[model samples]
Target: MSTTLSKSYYHATSSVSLSAVTTRDLLDSVAKKTPEKEAYIFPVEKVRLTFEELQRQVCTLGTGLLSIGLKRGDTLGIISSCAPEYIMVQLAAAYIGVVLARFHVGLPNSLLKSALLKSECVALVVGANNDDVYNQLELILPDLKTSHAETLQTDEKSKLQRIITNVEASQGRWKSIYDIMNLCKKDSENGKQRLEETSKMVEFGDPYTIFYTSGSTGPLKGTLHSHMAIQNIYMMCADRYEWTNDDILLSACSSLSHATSEMSHIAPLILGMTSVILSPGAKIHDNVSVIQNEHCTVLFSTYPGLYNLLHHGKINEYDCSSLRYVMTSASTIPTDVIQKVSSIFQAKVLHTYGSSEALFVSGRDITADEKEIIDKVGRPFGHTEVKIVNEYGKIVPINTQGELLIRSNFLFRYYIHDEDKTKQVMSVDGWYTSGDLAKIDRNGYIKIAGRSQDVIMKGGKTMYYASLVESLLSHPNVKAAYIVPVPDEELQEDFCACVSLIGDTSISSDDLKDFYKANIGIPAYIPKYVMVFDDFPEMLTGKMDQKMLTLEVFTRLGLNKEWLVHGRKA
Candidate 1:
């Protein structure tokens, strides 16, 4: 094992050795080791599966795919919410050696079609909750309603009718998940034979899943991860968090499309832990009940998720003592929120830093000091190396902000079918520039300043929006804060602070300006305008959509199109 510690960089090779294993093999191993252990629980749907049951379902689904003519290495698109079918399809796709491409259920029709076409998906699995999927299918495949084809039946007769109607219109173009399952039952023996042969053919380095980044800034790009990378990263995390078969993990995050949901789906399968998947739109109290009843050991969520739970004002009514760790990421979490979450759940708040391109880079331990827990995103994982470099590609000293570059065995293979775009972010030597401005302290803790694009240039000096937002978040009335740059004829660009306050508490624009001047003490850093709202527009991943917020600010201020720095028109 090799470990390096220096002011300019930090590197550590994992002390825990990992052997080559496919996701299918990993699940089979766990099922053999602990067949009776509960593997998945969906409280809202009233569904439960043991490790053996999960493996059986995955095999059945894999055979069903083979029976329906889905070849190995073919891309399968899953457009669904977090449900048992989603998990089953994900695991089954891996078993059949197909690349499972996740399609955000909330994506627009245009982008959704683009992703499907780009990934060359041969089949799609959709959910039945909302009519959005049917509506999108109408626009994408107009002939779907007119064709005659086999369709799946659901308990809801009306929903099943609508799905059949659409599937008929597709003219045998796509197969419904239910239809495929029925086909699997007809060819169980053949599917089992084929599943065994195909499982042996799958290599550890083959792509397992493709996740598209949340396109808050621009168009979404598809990222591919090998089976080895995904399995090892989650194994490392399971070790880091000391998870075991006895632990029950609960996730209130968004759909399985995002990386956050990977913890709920992938980690449990590898470690033989039980994962509770609450349906989308579940009430905060319902989540609390899952913890209290299921005795969940870990609650994984975004910062806003935990904040809303705490804001519900009934945490005291629920027994959350079983929770040992509250894991959060995807945005900057205020110090006050961290303290309140720890107090409410009686669990340590652990923060993690990762992106779709890079799987799991760094995280803070639950036993970290309060200051480190609140301020830094902790040290890099044992298998990862991190360094901060200036624009000149030179390493920066400790405590100095620069672009963060990471080298890890868990990084994605590349952006699918976009070598030019992939080359822009990743270097030949395996360093993936994160496009995040950050700093490392002498103690090796990493502090993310902000995204490089989020920097506001004022009077020839750099100002970080995250720093300003963090400063304002310290105020008692502020619930969330964001800063964006607006065009200025004289200064080139000016800063605008968008704030959402606590319930029934109002802070005036003048008062905010005064507060900033008193606290920050930087005249140029003070916001030229303060915009308050009941809530900020959020992306699917639960992070504030700064791009949308900026446009809202421009329209509210009645700024001219020419005055906008990015030339965004009204």
Candidate 2:
């Protein structure tokens, strides 16, 4: 029943004075001590914001929000590309205990509107150049896109298309970014006074954000978190990962995902480190340049993006020797991908597993051995307890694969209003069932197999789709992979892999099958069919839509009759 961190290596070696401060207090303290130290690096434009300056801007925006009668615990809808302004607004909302109902600008405007309306956002702040956002809103009510040229990217083909599609000239309700900033800046002198008012009675347990599940499975639901959750991440990273204020962290990936929400956004900001924020519409090439030019010490990216960087030979050319850590999350990384990326960048890559409902559970610790790195996600950090359980919630034996249930120092309030779904998955006894299946070794390192629903049973042997997908993704030519279990008259169920390869790479399906069989140690089960794709259909958060991929496979190969033998078709 205890939530306190056990007296382990973390408790024995460290001074625990950091426990007293919350995330909001951490930001305020950093602003005071290192006001002029660079707080953020803009990788696209090479712009950097000092800690003090960032706080000042946050305060100004906070005052502007307060003047408009926003209150604590009120949700503020934010949809914009990554910018210093975005960071400013995020911090301002945190300072006032405003729960951030964050939405990525890339999200379909229809989905964005639904989420906003559901969160009941009292106020909204957006980038000046978001014509797409305004146009989408204009279909319902009057709004304007911000006309700031600097915030808008001119050359990107996809970005331009979005802009054109969303902006309607006839609608007059849109507001300009210039006008909003001007008003906030004019009232900058009173920003601190506003921050004081917001923080006067705020506490560590107060809710600060409500991030949505990436919606890979179903409709997106908001997961509520308190400042205590943010502080828990900061403490765990500092206590275990050797993070410090001197580290220069670059989050080229958007901060909306569950992994980046904790790692890139909260970890660096609360630790008083220099964070490099990517400009909206920034590319991977721009990230390489930032690493070299900005002397980025730490890097964070998704599994596919990490592979894409290495496969394109971008990592070899960049002078990123200053880099010490590279982390990937939301999915597992292949051993081959890690070995190549490590050799090229000369930095250790860490893999972590968690959910939007709970921040972090198990991570591949840097200090752990190669076997721990490859075979398992490392031991739990700080006050987190990981348990492997059966269908009845009974604890499973070590080295036995079961659903991963996490009991952490922090947990989300609820999944918005979906109380039924919340209670079904999140146990009242402090455990949140991850829906992911993993086996805990005797040493306590956990190896992820696949999601419980994603596991396929054939002839009484369970085949993990993710384990197969991880193997295929390790191939040099495979840029990304998806595995689908289709019904087979011979085997009951069999897996077929769909892969998106690197451009102009002429690797054949036979070659791929041989590669996986040789490397992964399973020849007969190495995917009966391997289909290649040029690009993947992704949800707004950049994670591949497996459901859509499966549907495509169903249509192309007509596998629906094969797989839907017992269960109804979705």
The prediction achieving the highest lDDT against the true structure is 1
Error of 1 at 536 (Å): 1.4
Candidate 2 stretches with Cα past 4 Å from truth are: 1-23, 140-195, 254-259, 470-479, 510-526, 559-570
1-570 per-residue lDDT for model 2 (tens digits): 012322211111224333545556777788898888888777665567787877766666666666556778787777666475567777877877787777766666667667766677766665555656655654533222344332222222211111211123424342333343455566665755776877776787888787888887678888888888767765776566687888888776754434355566666566788877776477777777788887888888777678667756366667898899887775466677788777778888777767777777667667777755575666676677778878887777777778888877666878886899889878778778788888876566778887888876665567778777777777877877888777767766777788888779998888887777787776545787788888777877877887777778778887664355464221
lDDT of 1 at 527: 81
Per-prediction TM-score to the true structure, in the order listed: 0.93, 0.86
The clash count of every prediction, one per candidate, is 5, 6
List pairs with backbone clashes in candidate 2: 35-52, 128-146, 143-173, 143-174, 144-174, 487-562
Which run of 10 residues does model 2 get worst, by summed lDDT?
A: 157-166
State candidate 2's TM-score. 0.86
Model 1 per-residue lDDT at 222: 95
- Candidate 1 lDDT at 115 equals 87
Query: How does residue 554 of candidate 2 score in lDDT?
Result: 79
Candidate 1 lDDT, 548-567, residue by residue in tens: 88789988988765555554
